[model samples]
Every structure is written in C-alpha cells, then in structure tokens.
Target: MTTNTQNLSGQSILAGAATTGNGRAVHGYNPATNEPLEPAYSLIDLDQLKIATAAAAEAFESFRSLEPAKHADFLDAIAENIEAVGAELAARAMAETGLPEARLTGERGRTTGQLRLFAKVIRQGDQHGVRVDPALPDRAPLPRVDIRQRKIAVGPVAVFGASNFPLAFSTAGGDTASALAAGCPVIFKAHNAHPGTSEIVGRAISKAVADFGLHPGVFSLVYGPGATIGQALVADPVIKAVGFTGSRSGGTALMATAAARPEPIPVYAEMSSINPVIFFAGALSEDPAAQAKAYLGSVSGSSGQLCTAPGLVFVPTGAGGDAFAQAISSQAPNTAGQTMLTEGIYNSWIQGVEALGGQPGVELLGRGTEGAGQNAPAPAIYSSSVEQLLENPVLQDEIFGAASLVIRYDSAAELVTALSKLEGQLTATLQLTDADHETAAAVLPTLETKVGRILVNGWPTGVEVGHAMVHGGPFPATSDPQTTSVGTLAIERFLRPVAYQNFPNALLPRPIAKDNPWNLTRRIDGTLTTTGE
Candidate 1:
C-alpha cells in the first residue's frame, strides 16, 4: 500500500468537535473549586472529525493484513504502555473527576486487564470458531451440509469516552482495546468530561504506535462536546462500527444518528439497566441475615455507581423486607458520601430517590442518607408491592446512583410476572441458599431471557475479563444484542466473517495453509476435522 506523509498535528487532540464554534481548546474545571483540571481540545468541526476518521479507516486496510501474532504484539505493547502510566492516569482521574483515589486505582487495573485479555485472545489470530457435524462418512450417499462459524473484522471504529470510568472506558478503554485487537482502526471522540485524561491515555497509546512502527492512522483521538462531533464520526462513510457506554438519552440520540446515515452502521452502545435481584421465601427461610449482608455490600459498593449493581431487590411477602432494609440501611449510613462524576450525576441520583417516595403506592423504606463530603449522598431505599413495581416504568429504570428499591412479592406467580416486564440489563442476580437451588433452577430460564449474564449470588460489579464474560444485555441494555461488552467475544462487534467456499488452496489464509502459520482450528471438507480432514 502506498503511504502519504501527512502532517500529524498534536493540536487535533486538543480541539473539540468543530461544532463548538471557532476552533479553541475546552479546559474542563473542577465543579467544586471551579479550577481547571488540565488543558483539553475544544469542540471540533465536522471537517476535523472527517480527517481523523478517514485516517483510521485507511489504516485498517494495512493493519488487518498483518499476521495475527504480530498483531498481538502491538496490542500487548499498547497494554504495557498504558500500564506504565496507570498511576498517573489514576491520579489525574481523581483530581479531575472528583472520584476517590481507591476507586480510580481499581478502575485503572480493570482498564489494563481488559486490554491484555483481548490481546491474548486475538494474538493467536484464532478468532474462536467451531465446526459441528455428525460424522457423515457412513451416513449415506448424500452428505449433510456442514456448519462453520468464524469471527472477522468489520472495519474502522468510533469509541466515545465515558465520564464515570475515565480510564477504563476512555481513549484506551475496553471498546478501543477490543476494536484494535479485532484488526479495526479506532477513532476515539474524547469525552468532554475528561479530555485531559483521554489525552494522557492517548499519549500512552501513541508511544505503543511508535514502538511498534505501526500504521499511524490506526489510532485517532478528537475532542468535541456538541453532538456535531459525535454525529460526524458515526455518520462518516468510513466508520463502520461504534462503541458507547452512557445515559439513555445520550446513547439513544447517537444511535438514531447512526441509523439515519445513508448506510447504517452497527452501534454497540450499552445504555442503562436496573439489574434486579430476586429473593424467594426460601432465601429468607434459609438465611435472612446472610442475604441482607450480601445485598448491602452489592448495592453500596462503588456508591452504587456500578452499572450492574443490584438496583432493585424483590422479596417474598413478609419475607424479611424490614430485616433486609435495615441491614442495607445500616451499611448505607457508614458509606462516606463520595463525589459522583459530576454535579449532574449527584443531582440525578437524588431525584430517583424522591421519584419513588413521591409515588402513591410507594413508601420510603430508608431515605437516602449522606455522609458530609465533597459530593452529595446517594443512598435511597423505597418499598413497593410487586404489582406497583411491575406497572411503573419509573421504578424499573436505573437510578444511576447509590439507590436501590425493595419490592415485596406476594407469590411466585407475582414474582414471575414482575420479572417478565423488566428492561434488558447487563446482569440479574439471584440470592438463594443451597437448599433453594431447585427453585433457582426453575427460574433461571426466565431471568436469562432479558440479561447478558445471570449471577447465582455474586455482585455484578468488578467484571472479570474471561471467555464467559458478557457485560452487555438486550435492547436498551446494549444497542447490539449479539455483541458483548466484555470477554473475548466482545471482539466480534468489530468483526464479520466471510467464507471461502472451494477456493484454491493457494488463496486460503496462512492460518489455513498447507503448513498452518498460526496453527489454528480449521474445517476441512465439511467435517469437524484438522487441516486436511
């Protein structure tokens, strides 16, 4: 491929999407002190967005052809470089976002871990695929058609940085890492909320770019607040996929914009979820104290900031609702009111608490209490009958803060009906004792229908990067139902498989070579066999 020596202006990194009026840098400040966190690129225009995205789009053509092993090396390099700056990144996140030190450090580790996990998966270039068939050698004269599934890259990608996870979901976060591993070039639109941190991560990635002598356009970071910046990136003809994690309105607006494009691209935007936990009579009958302790920790961790935190708990009629509420309330009072991502976040969480108590059938079980600190308190609890919860959309939506609702169910039938009406969520929890395992088994199918993951008795936060992790859910939980936000499968969002039916052996991928270069699993002559089955 011919190369163009284009000017690489570091300035593009500072300017927000061009729509923010005349070109200028947007300097984000601390909401409390009203002091600048650091210098950041102001709103960028449509033209700049095009320039950045176009470069990444072109880079994909070359990057995709490299051997998977070499690809893995570059990916590992990116992770290492980011890990090197883990401390600095975390510090800046705390200073800028008003997040506590401990939380940011944990998030930094998660970010790097996610990068390495995808690196390990695609480094072998064995995009997980399997061929299944009943041995047809003796099945008859006519043979059965074999089925093979493989993952491949879709194309250039656009990732929007999120406010809550400045490090994990920012410029070098899960979305960017997975896309790059899948052989897709990435154009990241820095979140207006954290451009400085985004640049810091961007710089770390740039170091990897130089170290690997990578195709420069493989990574592009631009800044802008106005929807125009995001609009241009998602609508561009060259951008084929997008990854987003944010509020319902923000993600939905972007999704609509992506669809309105002349050629719609896949938008894997994880919107919001309430992540409900159901506790049956057997749960309380088994160990009410233990369940209470567990729920308190799950909902209160991260100040209930985690997307998968159990926001609603369903208790059987007279099944220790008071005990559970008291347990959770006791723990809530001790949690120091930490600052949320912004004043808007602090305010939103409080409103969710009020909206519940404001409802007719609802009663405040525990008013959200706060420990005086930098940010407002978020702990809020309310009680409602199963019918009240099932009928109200407001009660079902995620409060997005440290708030959980305790709903009392009269019977199994009522419990089933309430769950059936839930919105798709990243995870759903079941707190049951060993003796109630039979009951859990019976309801597993119902819970699995609307969530990406079902947890037996684990808190959904602290996502583990593995083959089984599915951080995305149905419909509004995520824009793409088939793609996941975690795990090796997350790479599928950036890939699309193409078949080579009866192609000349010489034209096959090297992984499928006479002597496999990467030594990957392959389907031969319609059989679950080796290179030459």
Candidate 2:
C-alpha cells in the first residue's frame, strides 16, 4: 500500500457538506517526532454543532425506515469506500498516533471488516427482533388481541472518537458502524489528535450516504473542543443516545449530562479497565521466564495504550512467583519502549506510574529501556502483596501506558479476597493448567461478576471483532454492561424495542407485519418461524 495524503480539507463535514468552523483551530501532531502535521483543523462552535445534531435527527426518520437490502448495501458501500482509501488512511493514522504502519493497517482492516460484518447482520434481519402473539378471539371468556414487537433505531447517536484507536475507534469506526447499521444517523466528534485521519474516513462515510441516495444527515464529522461541543452534543434533544470510548472522567461526565436531560438516554461508553491476568502455579512452573516475557508483550504492546492491556497480574507467592518477577526484572531492561499515541497520554502515564510507585508497599519489579523517539517512555512493572493491593486503590488504577502492577498472593483465599476488591473490567485471564482447574473453579463466580470476558491460558491485548466478542463491561468499564461496543451486538445500543397491539397488518411495519415482507425469522406464539411458515 502507498501513502496518498491528497484531499484533506481540514474542514468539518456536516450532512454531506464541507464547512469550516469558526471556533479554535487545532492541528494533528506527530507524537513520535513532537511536530505538528499539515492543515490545522478548525473547531465548530455550539451553533454549528447543533446543525449537525438537527440534521442527524432529520436523517433518522428515513434511515430507520429503509429497506433491509438497501440498508445492508449502504453499510457494504461504506466498507468498500474505506478500503479504497486504505493506504492513505493507514499513513495519516501512523503519523498522528505514532503507531506503526502494520498496526494501523490492521486496525483499518478491523474497522472495514466490522462494517461488512454488520452489513451481513442487518441483512439476516434478526436484528429487527420481531415477535408476534396471535389474537385468540375464540378462546376463553376474555379475547386476546394480536400483539407484535420489533426493535427500532433510537434516533440520532453521538459518537466520541477514542484517542487510542484512531482508525478502529475514531471516525467510521465500530461505534459509527454499529449506529449506522442500527439505522441511527451518527454525529462523530473527531478526535483532535487525528483530525486529518478523521476527515478521510468521514468523507468515505459521506460518500456512501450520497451514493445510496440517503438523506445527507445520515452522517456528519465535526471538530470541536470536547468540553463544550461534546457535552452539548450529548445534551441535544435530537441525539437519542451516545457512544463513547475514553477515560473514566470523560465517560462519567457524558453519563451525568445525559442523565440530567429531560428524557434521560443511554450512554454506551467504554471507559476504564485494568484487564487482570491471573497466573496459577502450574502454568508458571513450566518456564516462568517465558511466561513473564509473554506477559510483558501484552503490557508493552502499542506502548500499553490498549484498553485490554493486562494492567494487573496475579502471581502465586513462592519460588515460581520469585522466578517470574526475577525474569521480568532481567528481561525488562532489554525491552525497548515504543512511541505512545500522544504527548498528553504520555504525560498521564508518567504521573500515574509515579503515583503508583509512591504508594506504600509498592516496589519497582522491572523497568524497560526508553525509546529514542519523543513522547516514548520506558515501561515499568511494580510488585505488591495482595493485602496491600486490597487496601490501596491507587495500585489498581490503570496507568494507560507501558506499565503494569504485579500482585503476589500466598493462598487461594488471599487471591480470591484481592480479586473481590477489583472494579468491573473488560476481561480477566486465568493462566492455569489442568491441575489448576479446582482453584479456577473456586474463583470463577467472582471473576464472572468482575469482568465481561474470561480467558484461560491467554493474554487480553488482542480483541477479536466477531459475533461473540464483548469489548465492554460493568460500571466504569462501560455505562451499560448489557450492551457491547464491538461486533454485531453493538447495534443493540442504538436500538429499542417497540410493541404494536391490536393493529391491522396494513398499518404494521414490514418487519412485524403478518406478511413478513423482509423474510425475517420471527417468534410467533413463542416459537421461531420463518416467513411462509
């Protein structure tokens, strides 16, 4: 693939129209070199932000009622459009995020792959969630009226781009893809760190909306101060829900704002998690050194910027644990740190690492070599006892970059007690052998409550985007644990079920009509049945 870098206007795209903002202008920066990129992006004010939301509300009406095939085709078109710009998109993302070309390219593939997956999902028609209860006029003293139910788009959605994933979690990313697949027009708030990348992807989505002859309001990408424009976008009456992926502070702020609205809406925000990795004695006994290296790979990958990076590792206290810690200490000095996503994130990582180090009972176990590039800091691993971990909340805080805490436990009881202290997380991995099943079983229930996904003998760095994958969890991990931010399940966030009763088939929507025009598999009288059945 070749770098294109051609038609980046650095303008806000509103309803298929390119418009420059009058608010403060910001430029994307190269974190690796500590230099600014070309074409400063102008931020939009509150009035201009309102225009995008209002247009999205308008687009939702027609978009929600689109034919299943056309809707599916629209999503497919977006994937194709993004793939067409794959080279340029990857290049811009690399320059802005300090991520390597291969990583950015893989992220771009994940983004487009998900879009195509959602296209298949919508075409399958099960997302409509059609259910019917037939009228029983001749049975019993009380006659039953026909009732039908199907999920509908919740209206316009406000998606905040994530700082870590400029391609897969920014403009035309999973949140935007899922919302559009659910038939909710999206108003994407471009991440300032990657404005040029946002514009390129945003244009791809805008092109799809136009090519499908859909309302221009189907998609809009705007640049603005997150404190002002971001909050206002969530508070807008037109936006029925929000999709956010960032810090705990940012997600909670949006949650508070949404709750304060006259009609409180759902905010599906993927916020904080220190995805924990547990090491059973048997698993680590084989080659504690190799296991330690694998753990570091997950910790330092992408400068530890991944949401699923193993922030907390539990090692059984004994010779094996000592060996593992010793291996980390010996190997870490040889490992080289990579460039972080941005300077702000790099600074935060430093502060968080320092705070953790300052806490009582915490000791540095290992520290990696610092990268030669700007904004790249050395990765560090710390050690603490389970008792200290349970007492100190600072030890559990996510450092967000190339840093992890290793907690040692003497017994299963102690380990379980410390595990209970953890907040909700996106994932938890149990590095256990067959002999360790009994111990794993004892802690399984507690793990179930604390995390959304559980893995055995693996790390949590790579998230597979598929039908069964869940990239969200309870509380601070996400506002709504019942929903997800990746895979086909993400569309559920932008949809709500509506039931129709005693309505004639002529007046019913196609998905729930007696004819089953969309040929969906619906539950009729509590049984799954296809059209013509």
Candidate 3:
C-alpha cells in the first residue's frame, strides 16, 4: 500500500491555517500490511515555535483577564467542539497508532469528558472561588492584613503532545483544555507520530476559538523535528510552564532545557513508568489464575502503551507464583502483537525489552520478543529477585510497550521494602484478600508514597474521571504532585494561585471580599467564608 508523508520542514506554520510543519513529514506506514497509510508531515519547527509561543503569550494578555464565566464557556465550547468531531479524531488516531477502534473511542470519550469536566470544574471554582486562608483579627488585640487567593494564569504554556493518546492528550486534549480553562494561552507541540491527527484536532480547536470569538493567539499548534525545537521552546521567555508525556530521556531533555532558561519556567513532564502491581499470596492464593486472567487484558491492552499498565508484578516464590506465571504465559501469546504508534516506537519497545531480558540476574519468564515489524512481539515477562530490583535502577525504567516483570520476594517485609524503592507512579495495585487486607493496610502508608493512586485487584489502565480520581503521582510519574492527569484537578496544571491583599472592592477578586464575584465560597476573618461575606 502507498502512504503519503506530510513535510513540515522549512515552512511557515503559525497564526494561519498552515499544514506546513517545520520538520520533514515522516511516512505513516500500515503496520499490518507494511504499506504507507498516507502522506504525513510534522508540525513546523524552531522559527514557528517562536511564532506559536509568542502568539500564545499575546493571547494571555487578554484571555487571562476575561471574566471567569467567559473562561468557563470557552472551556465548555472546546469540549463541545471535540465532541462534534469525535469520528474524525478517533479514526485518524487508530490509523496513526494502529490501536483498535473500541479503545480509541473509549479514549475519545475520556478526552471529551475530561474537557467537559474541566469546564464544569472551572465554572464551579468560579461559582465558589478557590479557597484562601485568611489572617486572624477582630478577636485578637493586634489586627492582621487580609489573605486572598485567586487562580492566576501563568503566561504562554508549552505542551508537548503525547504519542499514545493523540487526541485525548494531544492537540485538544487535557493539557490544552485545562490550560485554556485556566485562562492561559497554549502552544501545543504536536507529537511526530500522529501529526495528521494532531492537525485535525488542532483545526477543531481553532474552529472552536473562532466560533467563541476567542483570541487567536490563545492557541497555536506547531510541528517540528529534532530536539532543537523542543529545547528552544523550553528556553523561550514567553512560555512560563510546560506539560509533557513521553520517555525518560525525552522528558529529561525538555526539563533540563527549561531549567537552563534565563527565566526558568515550570515544566510538568510526566515520564512513563513501569507501574508496579503487588499481589500477596493470600490475595492470589484463592484465585491466582483469575488474577492472571484479568491481568491478561490489562497488561496487553493497547500493547502496554499505557503508563499505568502493570509492568512489575510482585509474587512470592512458590506454587502460587507458578500458577500465576502459568496463567500469564497461557494468556500472553494469545494476544498477538498489534501495531504500535510508529516504526520508531515499535523498535524502541523491542530493544528495551531485550535489553532488560539481557540484564544481569534477569531471566525471561515468558516467550516473546519486544517488538517486531508492525506488530510488537507478544507480551514479555521476566523474573527478578526483589533484592536485585532494590539494587538496580534499570529495573525501574519504563519499556513503553507490551512487557512486564515478575519480582519474587522472600517475605511480606521484603515486599514492603521493594515497594518503597520505586519512584512516583500513576498507580500501584494490591491483589489481596480479606486476610491479606491487614498486610495491605500496613503497606498502604509506604506504597502510597510511590504512587498517585492505590488500587485493589483492579487494573489502573482505565483511568476514571471523577472527584476522587488522582491520576498523577510523585516525581517522574508527574512533574507536580498537586496536579492530576485525569478528572477536574488536571486543570490545575494550567492554573497558578494569585493572592490579593487589602485592596479596595474594585481592586480585589470576588473570592476575597464584598465584590462576591461568582457568589460561592471564600474565607473571611479566619473562617470558612462564603460569597457575600
């Protein structure tokens, strides 16, 4: 089959309907047939980076000052627009990523839902403004000044599109939606693998903006190749904060660039993880086979492209472990490798899995190659002692494809210790029973330290969008501990709190005093303040 590649190199791409990206268009191939899907080009590059970011910064000057209601409406419109183009977005995503239609549709639902959720959240925040701690006074001999807090928009935001969720986490996804809702303009750097999908989503966003009469500078989606474009974007004075989801080396590079900026900016880069799931003997003893059965779908779902997919499974070295191992082996090969997002991605997954298998003290427990051709090798599982994992950093890095490790421990105490060694992650699961619940309780305090969320017997691959949902975790899992990747809280990544002192009613934001902007919630004289206080 023949495919077309879009070329973005040496082209102008910002402030207009330009498909020309700064980098050359890489070919989009059909993994199944090993044929080209379509001609695709990357988004434009460095020169365009400035154009996009500058436009976004320009937009913030006005967008940041809009009434909170207006901001909420715009957010709502974005979700609505994404909803309108659901089919096109999902179809392109499947073609680019080689994922099944059902998965992409679910992701699209989640994506649009996230946008709407943020809209609701921001409107609610306005209805009952962000909370602020007020100073003590009246009852005291000495009076203190007022303390006020308002969510402020940081300047232009640079968002690096994700390779996996091209629509939900890319162009019009959580990063852009939340940032815009926060009243910050956005500069979205499209991920190379799915630039066509990015363009479609980007166009949807642009149309939404025009329909809403929003500032054009408020959103600029650019494409480019090479590290230089991203490096330059991070260094730009106009971009105050960043959001990213990709590999460790890639994330680290952007972060270092941000840190090196003359006016250093905040970068929220979510490095992928080998999300670990712990299964106590008691938990698995009753239904080790069942646990493995459920995990078959979770681990192999999307070929393990999800960061929250279980990568490391902890089990005792005995009959139970053997049963679980057999279960995994029985189920793995059945799910043949589907196509990954790109050839480059497929290759990387293959190499990384082999590299891990080849690591000292590590043994392949299952039969499969990492990734091959358009399809990935079947899910690969390796066994390593908890002690080895504790001593080796290699055991923790993410492979970004269909793979996992089974870590054996001598005792529950050692299991606890091994859990403690892991860095922040999106999730940690405990496969336990009523009896093991006691052990799980003890491990919670330690396990929670390493992950944003803790699950019991359920897979973390399908993130729910709700109030209690916390989709971000400690370092590497997410750059900021306070922000979540799913649900309403995700918008916080795009917002910064600003405080107002004893300013006249006109000068103060509604949350602080008599102005009562949205007439919701607030703090007054060290009390739970409500609107009209």
**CA RMSD of each candidate after superposition:** 4.6, 1.7, 3.7
In what order do the candidates fall by TM-score, top score first? 2, 3, 1
The estimated TM-scores of all candidates read 0.89, 0.98, 0.91
Return the top candidate by lDDT. Answer: 2
- What are the runs in model 3 whose C-alpha is more than 4 Å off? 1-13, 19-23, 42-45, 126-140, 368-373, 510-513
Please give the ranking of all candidate structures by lDDT, highest first, separated by commas: 2, 3, 1
- Better candidate by TM-score, 1 or 3: 3
Q: Write the per-residue lDDT of candidate 2 for residues 8-80, one digit (tens) a residue.
A: 8889988988899988788999999989998999999999987898888888889999998999999998888
Please name the candidate that would achieve the greatest TM-score relative to the true structure.
2
Clashes found in each candidate (C-alpha, N, C closer than 3 A): 20, 0, 22
Residue 120's lDDT within candidate 3 is 75
Query: lDDT of candidate 2?
Result: 0.91
Q: In model 2, which residue pairs have backbone atoms overlapping below 3 Å? A: none
Q: On residues 353-425, what C-alpha lDDT tens digit does candidate 1 reach at each position?
A: 7787788798766543564454557566677887787677888878887777888877776777788888888
Could you tell me the TM-score of candidate 3?
A: 0.91
Return whichever of 1 and 2 wins on TM-score: 2
